[model samples]
Target: MIHNPNNILTAGKPLEEATKVMVMVHGRGGSARDMLSLSTYINDKDFAFVAPEASQHTWYPYSFLQPLQQNEPYLSSALNVLEMLRARLQSDFNLKPSQIYWLGFSQGACLTLEFLARNPMRYGGIFGLSGGLIGPEGTSRDYAGSFEQTPVFLGCSDTDAHIPKGRVLETEAVYQRMGADVTAKLYPGFPHTINEDELKIVNSLISGQ
Candidate 1:
């Protein structure tokens, strides 16, 4: 049996009754409940929000920049968590990939992007706040498949203590190369936290306003 270490927290409309879905992933040391709180700011009545909890409130134990092997089965397990949620949305709620959005912050952002890279498709949207693709600087990202014009938003401070701006740009380039509609914003001297601008963009994206 594949151990699923995820406890999903949901908000907004039930999946079966909603037209849209948002799979929210939390940062390291953050809970699914905390990720669900963002739905209050998003405030999309037609959307079903699902947040998956990490075991012990952490998806992996090392920095995203560390070697892939170092993260090991924990990283693979985290990816499986997202996959399981996506499958549930498809099987139980009958939602399509294009109706599902991926959103995350910090370490969660890294995991979200990594999973997306491995499985590219036309998603509703993707929000990566203060994060980048996994692995070290010289890691090869020869991911197959295409995003098919999926809109992706990546926001990070130019001097974030945890993320490097270059990595964010690289992620943008990779997604764009895979046919995604990429929008990357670099905030100068901004703190390592989500800003009003990011929230506003997300609300607009999810609301179609």
Candidate 2:
């Protein structure tokens, strides 16, 4: 009779046969089903794909540019959801952080960055589309952790209405400082949507190419 705030939808091979697990987070107003839909473009049956749905189809009800505290319990809850899923994968499925990958879009991308920043590790890969760190402009990150050379790919629109390019650049710099091998690409005058080139890059990342 109780309701869970997080609902997880899974695809691909089960945890036993699949050594790789991709955690896909959806943007604000997006569902776990929508996040799982991305698997259509990516052909990989060896990897397990999991997406977590946020309550009411939103992570936090404000711009990521806002102060971190402004996002409050909702943001914390969202990150906690990811943490739970990661822990389950490590415990139940006997998977390590290095075998786990993350891919997210828009608001979900920001969430991904924040979560990884709090819990640093050598993950398989990270792809963030049109998003960046969470907090106001010039917020002092001073985060204490290292990614240990994990590969991170960031793709953003130079003219995205929601996410400014400067934040993306700042996030890339932060990732590099945290010991991540970062690759950043900005499309000029691009809308808030993924393009073929980005998809191709994602495919390569997913395929470990």
lDDT of 2 by residue, 126-185 (tens): 999989999999899898889998889999999999999999999999999999989999
Which portions of model 1 show Cα errors greater than 4 Å?
1-6
The TM-score of predicted model 2 comes to: 0.95
Output the number of the TM-score-best candidate. 1
What local lDDT does model 2 show for residue 118? 81
Write the residue-wise lDDT of candidate 1 on 11-86 in tens digits: 9998779999999999998988989888888866788899998887888899999999998889999999898889
Distance from true location, Cα of 101 in model 1, Å: 0.5
Output the worst ten-in-a-row residue range by lDDT, candidate 1. Answer: 1-10
Give the runs in model 2 whose Cα sits over 4 Å from its true position: 1-6
For lDDT, the strongest prediction is 1
Report RMSD (Å) for each prediction in the order shown.
Answer: 1.5, 2.0
My TM-score estimates for the predictions, one after another, are 0.96, 0.95
